[model samples]
Target: MLNYRNALRVGTASCLEETSVDVSYEDGSPDDDDVPRRAIVAVLPPDQETRILMLTTYLNLARCASHVGRNKDAVVCATLAAGIAQHDEHTDHLITAKILRSRAHLAQNHLKQALRDSAAATELAPSDHKSVQLLARDVERAKRAALRANKQLAKEVSTWVQSAQSKFAEQGGNEADCAQQ
Candidate 1:
């Protein structure tokens, strides 16, 4: 039986295994952010190099899965991306993680969940950018759509309740007893 940390270590190792062959020098540096893809991939330990590639690869693959209506696959990819990104705890990585999670929910047909996450990401970002604002507005639209859907569901439920009440009344048509009912 492995502990939680060791289990995660194993998971991260599996993710990094793919990139190990290419990254000849693994220094386990936290300050590797200057090297673009290399930097992101190098954040993990030497043994976990493949896991980094797996994480990034899944992030890219999630979008394609969404297009093909493979929602379960999309969700799996996006979730992996978010989890890996969040592991780093860097601000940019957190933003990426939030977006990945949001997109995964969206792909799974959970627009409300996506909107909530997008809103959270917008608030989490420090600066005002056009893309951030756009995401925020998209979240608003998702909220409206979810509200409308809820209202429709409520109406249907109300109708069913009324129908059931009428049926009960018709069956128990005795004056005093029915009135009490």
Candidate 2:
């Protein structure tokens, strides 16, 4: 049988397999944010109660990080908490982790990822939970923010394309005149 430390190591390794963003949009590299994967829970033991306590700590850390505008840090903390709270007995912690993660993603403007986490939390929590209602409102705010960002990006792209086309036409006209001469 594996030693307790070895089992904890293996468990931590397995938990790192989860994707950073569940609903990816354009192709992109994995988020190698500053938070080291193992460092987040390196001292975790195999005990269930300790794990639950650590989950609470991480969730609190995530909330504080988000409040300070450190969204990437918040995401990392919440993700680690979620990984630790995977057992049936830790359902409430898992829900809190998902909600915190969703908020972090929303702060970072990752609309799809935020929605995915929010949905997971909603599914896990009772329909009448106060946090679930708050999450619904957060989702609405995220949708509006995403729409505004999309509109801004579209305008920027259109302007860039127009400028590029005009420059190309100017170069083509100059080349034609040079050929005639």
Off by over 4 Å in 1: 1-52, 167-181
Question: What lDDT does each candidate get?
Answer: 0.57, 0.70
Q: What is the C-alpha RMSD of each candidate to the true structure, in Å?
A: 10.2, 9.9
lDDT tens digits, residue span 12-129, model 1: 2223433331222222322211222222322343445665676678777876877777776776566556555655444565466566667667656688778776876787787675
Cα lDDT of model 2 by residue, 24-114, tens digit: 1111323233223433344456787787788789889999999999998998788778767764257888899899989999888888888
RMSD of 2: 9.9
**Cα TM-score of candidate 2:** 0.62
Error of 2 at 142 (Å): 1.8
Predicted model with the maximum TM-score? 2
State the lDDT at 42 in candidate 1: 25
Point to the candidate with the largest lDDT: 2
